[model samples]
Target: MKRPNGEKNISSTITLYADDGREFKQTFTIPLKANTPPPKPGYAVAKTTGTPAYYVLCITVPDMDKTAGEGFA
Candidate 1:
């Protein structure tokens, strides 16, 4: 599947299909925050002065795929 991209925060679930036909469900969200400044010639990494964004992932195992309130695995 294509990766999602945007300036807004995202929170949703997605399904993944394995090569062996093992279908699995997973939920993931990417938070959109301020853009960090680009690194200069001497900088090894770009520094972020603002709040950092985050990613949340919740995967459902094969055995418990049908359980209710099964958030993160």
Candidate 2:
């Protein structure tokens, strides 16, 4: 759910700065799509080095799904 400020409940806004000291705040929204069955509940964000990585390496699942529990919806 989004908060009053339009920020997602699971995340918060943060300021990012470049090496040049330029700072900016960006609003990002994560999508939920599972191609394979979840192994466990919770989520993960994998970091990669080089070539501006961060291309499709994350997980977002409810606690129940991560713990082998049934999802309510």
Candidate 3:
């Protein structure tokens, strides 16, 4: 999915297929801003001042066993 130019935020849904024929899905939104810090272990700041600008979208997925297999396991 691609964010249109000048949009304030972008969002998309992601789906993951497990080995046991189960599927997990989640939607995420990322805001576009300047002078903001990126996630840990990131490449560059999100459009920081006086630096080369880069847009970053970080997605954090929880432990799969706890999220995908809640009670079915």
Per-residue lDDT tens digits for candidate 1, residues 1-73, read 5533433334455667889998877655555453443233321334455578444444434444345575742
What is the TM-score of each predicted model, taking all chains together?
0.21, 0.21, 0.22
Candidate maximizing lDDT? 2
lDDT of 2: 0.55
Tens-digit lDDT track of model 2 for 1-73:
4334333334445567889998766855555344444346555667777787765556665554344346454
Error of 3 at 41 (Å): 31
- Determine the C-alpha RMSD for candidate 1 after optimal superposition of all C-alphas: 17.5
